[model samples]
Target: MKIILISLITLVSLVSCSNNSQVVSPKLDPLNQQFISEDELFRLVLHMDKLDYRSDEKIQLHSTLEYIGTEKKATIWHGMPYINYLITDGKDFSVGGVVSTILKSTTLEKGEVYTFPYIKTGAFSENDPNADFWREFFDEKDLYLPPGRYTLTVYCGFSLTEDVVNSKYNNKVEVEITVD
Candidate 1:
């Protein structure tokens, strides 16, 4: 009787363990940030709430633009200042996402800083133009990034003149993150 009871208990435990199946997202490694540019006309600072994340987790990124000039400067530009991210895996690069910022033309006072709200990486349009015609081809799933080491370089704004962007004032911040 003792032997039979032990066999039955072991079988029950095995069946119960096998029934416990749950879907869990992959875990990510810690994030790393690198600042490349030193031009002080406008400074871009990046902040992430947590360094590590899972594939299903939302990567919350906050960026701020501070006017570091001594006096007020006329910041003239075309459209609203937008964000572009270049993500790479040491081999190839992917246009991670783009935030289509819609802001009216404005000037920045000395020492004034503009902080943008946290932009969730999971819910961004992957460089989509957001036109009414091409809406059908884009979806949130298309932007799903797998677990890997990614270096994300963010360009804050485009230069007023194409030549200046190539030669001077290309404000940007680069950060490295691991998504597992």
Candidate 2:
């Protein structure tokens, strides 16, 4: 009887431990403006005002990083622009901005959130081969996306510490949009 009781307690403990280690899926906002990706230490959310737009409309994009680990605080080391955006038509058209090479760090406590916005400067040179195509798609005066479907991916490139790891993390979330 004593042996049976000990076995049952051990089995119950094992089951509870396994349950605690199970992966949890990221939750989404009801309105769909926020798309989420997560890991054991953090949660990244990509935010777009809407999923549909006109050919001449200006799209606003940003991302947020939230510390979700059990630790009191976590430090992330990355480039000047920790988070960046990549917009692609999945064919011939793609647009992304250059990021500064300067290193930076940010620390966050559990449940704290940090925001990063998409920013671009300068325009394509007129002498470039794709100058005409780029002019039609965007200009220095205003930014617009041509009429088509696009996949916008927001990625946060960082490492847990300043020390070089075997591989750094580029956590990203992709969402599709349409322009009439």
Candidate 3:
């Protein structure tokens, strides 16, 4: 009985030591806006550089599209890449234009990461029919964000669909951002 007890104590100590040394990654936000398609072929991860921002400051964000399936997948997008943002209170800041060509597709292999250029968030507007404020050229006009909390949604895709102005993205990631 004495020998058995000593062995048990030694095993428990080893287990405890291993558990203490185990590495754990930080948990992502519940609303960080990660989505996997119904088929599980692709995963979309969307997040902003920071959770809070000063008024009129440029809010930077990134969208990463990863192919998770065993086989390579190709998807079509017609025009330049853009993110669709819809705030919680029913305000939106989005833009889309005509695609000169037809059927632009991007192919990705398993475990591949497709990186997009850092995109800056736009000001919220309900009456800007043109949605021109989302454009980078109009930086002078982008200083219109008010002090409040807003939901920053990012839909990853080419902005060249009939529902570009109205339809939300099938694969989207979102994050809650604040303006102070």
- Summed backbone clashes in each candidate are 1, 0, 1
- Candidate 2 achieves a global lDDT of 0.69
Q: Which rank order by TM-score, best down to worst?
A: 2, 1, 3
Q: Write the per-residue lDDT of candidate 3 for residues 37-143, one digit (tens) a residue.
A: 32466677665556777887865554566667666664434333433444453364332221123233444567766654342332323344554533343455332
lDDT of 3 at 127: 42
For model 1, name the residue pairs that clash: 28-180
Model 3 stretches with alpha carbons more than 4 Å out: 1-39, 75-77, 82-89, 92-102, 118-137, 140-144, 158-169
User: What's the lDDT for candidate 1?
Assistant: 0.49
Judge candidate 2 at residue 107 and give its lDDT.
Answer: 77
Query: Compared to the true structure, candidate 2 yields what TM-score?
Result: 0.71
Model 3, position 115, has a per-residue lDDT of: 51
lDDT tens readout by residue for model 1, 28-107: 22235424344557776665555456877766655556667655674534223344455667873354444223222345
Candidate 2 vs 3: which has more TM-score: 2
The model with the greatest lDDT is 2
lDDT of each: 0.49, 0.69, 0.48
Error of 2 at 49 (Å): 2.4
Query: Candidate 1, residue 140: CA error in Å?
Result: 3.7
Report the lDDT tens digits of candidate 2 across residue range 1-180. 554456445544543454322112244333448899999988998877799999878877667788899899988776545677778899966876444444566677898677666654324556668778876665444447788999988887677788736437768899999999
TM-score quality measure for candidate 3: 0.51
